[model samples]
Target: MAATVFAAQGASVAAVSTTVPAVKEHLGLSATATTVLIVAVALSAGAGSFAGSAAIRRSGPVAAMRGAVLTSAIALLLIGWAPEQATVTAGYLLFGLALGGIDVSANTRATAVEHHYGRSIFASFYAAWSAGGVTAALLTAGTARLGWPPAATLTAQAALVLLLALTLRAHPLPAAPPDPATATGTPPIDLGRGLWIRLAPFGVVLLVAYVVDSTVSAWSTVYLHQTLAAALSAAPLAYAAYQVGTVTGRSCADHLVRRAGPAAVIRIATLLTAAALAGMAAAPGWPYAVLAAGCVGLGVSALAPLCLASAGRLRPGAAEAVLARLNVFNYLGVITGGAASGILGSAGHFRLAYAVPSALVLVLLLTARSFAPAQGVGGGVARTSPDW
Candidate 1:
């Protein structure tokens, strides 16, 4: 059920990416304006993470998760139905808030489930998210073929995704007891000592990883068309290849992490990311570019899931509070990645944009060891059985 919530979120995100060109055309938005809108959405999402922490403390994780999904549904409707840029931008902010809330709430819930089940399953949950994205991309293509308006298509997808989220409310876990930090008159998350250094690296890694994603998603089509001279009809292949690679890598990520641990998984994945980016930056043609995108997708796939799983297990406060803090990095990544790519793309530096993120990943390599475990899941939160 927690995974389903995340899957629904992924589908909505994929749907939006699928329709970006259409949305831009419809609203008469420049590339810069659209990217700025994304930045705004990301900022709101960061703020929403804090708000979600408070919501979790008051209403329990279950309610907060449900609310976040429902909120996203409404935001989608607004974005789909809106006639002007301002209205659509406002809708994105609302959607961002929902995304932030869901990120903290669902992951916190999933961390508990993973620990209870023993071994590793968090990466599998993220695999479901990638699969959901692929499914949505397929849906978007079908809708486009049927001559459905982007607005109608997005609205319909939102409704279906929301219904799916609604049905999964309590299957895997019941409502969490309200986090006591709200009532204890204390800071929600413990930012003490080693926890800060441990968490600080995640922010940098997540930001760099997300910028890579943003650069590709926002500009792959343009890069293929303008730089590689691919026909417009075939430009989307780069994005599609990336999604497929992500699904492929993530499908086995949990097993790999379980066998090797998070630090090793992340280190190997980071190297692959750097190698892929170098290939992408120097690709001679469309086919090479497309293939490199798959590598990027596959290598970058492990970071988010691993960082999140490790963060949730790091204890000093409730997982909800800890996750809420970690989730802000996602928005920072989204905002900066999208905004940077948008700027570079506007200046006609499409080929160079992917390189920036690649170079940033090398810097991230320095922090790879931060993902190492200092301790197991904090005591008293939940019990685990190896038999599972």
Candidate 2:
């Protein structure tokens, strides 16, 4: 159920990306205005993370996830049918909030499931997310080919998200008591300095990962259409290709971690990502850009799940609280990448957008050692035999 809802969130992200051109055309929005609109989602999502943490502390992850999925559906509906820029902006804000809440609540639940299974299973959950993104990206392309307007395309996607929300059912987990700090409404940041210090490296990796992600997912279509001269129906292919690569990479991440270790995996993936970004920056045509985007996905796929999984281990009993704090970096990356890429793209420097982040990703090599002990075998987080 956790993975399922996460997939729905991925689908929403794809829908937003695929419809960017339509949204801009329909509302006559300037590129600068569009950048603000996208950044607003990240800022609002950061605030929503705290709200999700509070919901988890009060009613548990299951309940919080249900609320988030429902909110996502509503946000989609508003965006799909809105007649003006202001209304669309409102919808975007709501979507951002829902996206943030889902990030915290779903990841919190995912780590619990990972703990129960006693191995590196977090990557598989992200694999499901990428799969959903692939499906949505294709749906967008198909809808556009059939001459569907953005409103109709988004409305159909909204219905799919709503259907996913209705299927959610809670499964019982091992009985554990709630943390007293959470019960008393204390903020997650009030936790000791040592925990934040431990989170720093993982947080940096996550920040860089999302910078790569937001750049590709949020602006690749625009880059393809404007920079590479791709047709409307074809622009979304780059995003779809990226998600397909992520699905493939994440599907194999667990086995690779078990064989080579998390630090090794991070180091190798970071190098691949940096190279792929440079390739993307230099692609001479949309086809080459699409292929480079896929490589980017393959290389960056493991970094996020590993960063998150390692951070969860820092305070197992307070996973929700800790993950919420980590989300600060996540949103910061999104805002930075989304806004900067948009501004650069607006000024017709799309290549620079990808090129700059390539160097930023190389910084992750320094943080690879932080995940050396993230696996159970290394005496990081404890493991239990598969409950199944």
Candidate that scores best on lDDT: 2
Top TM-score hit = 2
The superposed Cα distance between candidate 1 and the true structure at residue 220, in angstroms, equals 3.0
Mark the 10 consecutive residues where model 2 has the least summed lDDT: 175-184
Residue 260 of candidate 2: its Cα lDDT?
89
The residue pairs in collision within model 2 are none
lDDT scores in order = 0.74, 0.86
Write the residue-wise lDDT of candidate 2 on 1-388 in tens digits: 8778878888888888788887888788999999999999999999899999889988878889999989988898888888999999999999999998999988887777776555788898899889888988998899988988888999988887888788888765553223311232444445577888889998999999999999999999999999999988999999999999999999999999988899999999999999999999999999999999999999999988998888876666678889999999999999999999999999999999999999999988888877855456223343433211
lDDT accuracy of residue 336 in candidate 2 = 98
Cand. 2 Cα-lDDT = 0.86
Candidate 1 residues 280-350, lDDT tens each? Answer: 87899999998998899899998888778777766624777777777767777787788887788778877
